[model samples]
Target: MNRREWGLTTLAGLTGLALPRATSAQSAGTGRGYRYVHLDVFTDRRLAGNQLLVFVQPAGLDTDAMQALTRESNYSECTFVWPPEQPGTDHRVRIFGRTAEMPFAGHPTIGTAFALAHAGVLKPAMSKTVFGLGVGPTHIDLEWKGRQLAFAWMTQLKPTFGKTVDDAGGLAAAIGLEKDAVIRPAQEVHTGSTFLIVPLATRKAVDAAVLDRAKVDAVLTAAGVQRRGLYVFSTERGQDDATAYSRLLGSGGIEDPATGSAAGPAGSYAVKHGLVPSDRAASIIFLQGVLVRRPSRIHVNVASAGSEIASVKVGGTSVVVGEGSMSV
Candidate 1:
């Protein structure tokens, strides 16, 4: 489909969903308020990707208020954009999960860039923007199809390969998969965020896997990587355009539809382990969130310099679904 046709189809699909409405009760009182934009990240169509809420003008909102709003929305993550405190950055974005603030996250970073552009804070002529995240300065490159933002890519930190877990049976059981389904030993990888990358045998194995939180935590804790979550993936692709199928199961068995932070490391791991050709630049597409009905397609590009990974970039498209305001 053409760009216009694709945009219209996405709009039509999301129109029926409830748009954000101002909280009249809170607006009536002395409570402060902030405007927010709703977005679906990592998908061209609406309502099918990971959801994000972005507060475009969150001047008065404190940390407590941001955390409260994140819990209220119950989305995987939310972002509050602030004036840049550092040099050469466009804005400073604070990302918050359902319960606490995060150092950095994938969907929120790209989704917030789209949100800023949609809100007119970013001009169409501007092709790039940098966000000062908790992890430090994060650079985002923008691609525009005419005036519309077609895609955004975030350059993540260099990959740090950590401990390798030798307990294949324990790792498999943690995610309710058979030991035979594991194709290789699990290893910890960090690119801003940390995830234990588990190589599974097939797409069916990835989809069939379920998170056993207690067991998974036990395995991670034993490896001295208790803070990291499980990122199970199979290089065997069920979709023609994808290189892999994957899932991110965090503590409490919560599954993220799309994980941008993990995608960088995932691509790095793929190139290092020969899952993808390492002779040249590698571009990998990961299909995730299908099991939860919210499908997300994440793109990763890895540049190799000799035996080392030169750079890692994670990117995707996002749709601005809805908008509204809430009291802070």
Candidate 2:
């Protein structure tokens, strides 16, 4: 086991105290109670999408304790919310990577929205929830199935374009991939945070890739990227022809089943590379996670004006899968 896991396990054993079981409980209220909601992001079926752990009405937990709790949960990332303590603010969300706190995460946003729905917080159900985050705020749109919230559409942060890596071959090796699998002129993409995007020749390449964290971290650190990103595309372009079929991976030890942030820039790559015919505009599907048994779907849109591209967008549905209580 990794040191992080071992430490957590050892700590748990030594204290003779197990983590608070991930079960829904009643909120401290006269009537409304707390409930846990599980969302499977970027997939249609349960367990097919990236699993998320959401804790609702976590008003008592402080930031340091929340970070510790995230390590205990050990998912790629965990999200906790303090119910609206003031007007105009929906919820205060705190995000944490297994080892540290993060400013934002896409899957968590979608998953949290659905969790709120499952808990009946969004019963009247407006079109969406504008989750307040550290960086700023993100929106989540809800879909109703006869008063029951079934799906949520999250509008990711406004994307940012960064320097291009342009070395598909070397990057492929950085992630334990073959030269042929690397896509040429791969660029860095981000929305709110930075990620190095190295496209591979096929989805098979991405599926087989195992990121050498040390190498990836070095490159990303030098380039000022918060994380390394890997995107693989299918030759067969589905959806609109302007963007190519693709999947995205991050620097986190755990692979992201789908990366909406990466999708935004990947769509532009398809348009500029001629993989997708975007003489006018760019938009496409980025199918991810089929190789990992977590079938995921992500949509990307690119706006190109003449020879220059104007902007990009990524949209997807997040399914809430599970919830937990943290007492560490």
Worst 10 residues of 1 by lDDT: 274-283
Best by lDDT: 1
Q: How would you encode candidate 1's per-residue C-alpha lDDT over 1-328 as one tens digit per residue?
A: 9999999999998997897866887457746668999999999999988999999999888899999999999998999999998998989999999889999999999999899989888777988899999999999999988888889999999999999888888888877888888877788898899888888999998888887777777887787776577788888856477888999875565778999999888888888888878643356889999988899999998987789988899999999899998885
Which candidate wins on TM-score? 1
Cα RMSD to the true fold for all candidates: 5.8, 10.2
Residue 86 of candidate 2: its Cα lDDT? 46
List candidate 2 stretches off by more than 4 Å.
1-35, 84-89, 176-180, 213-227, 235-253, 272-274, 279-283, 303-313, 320-328
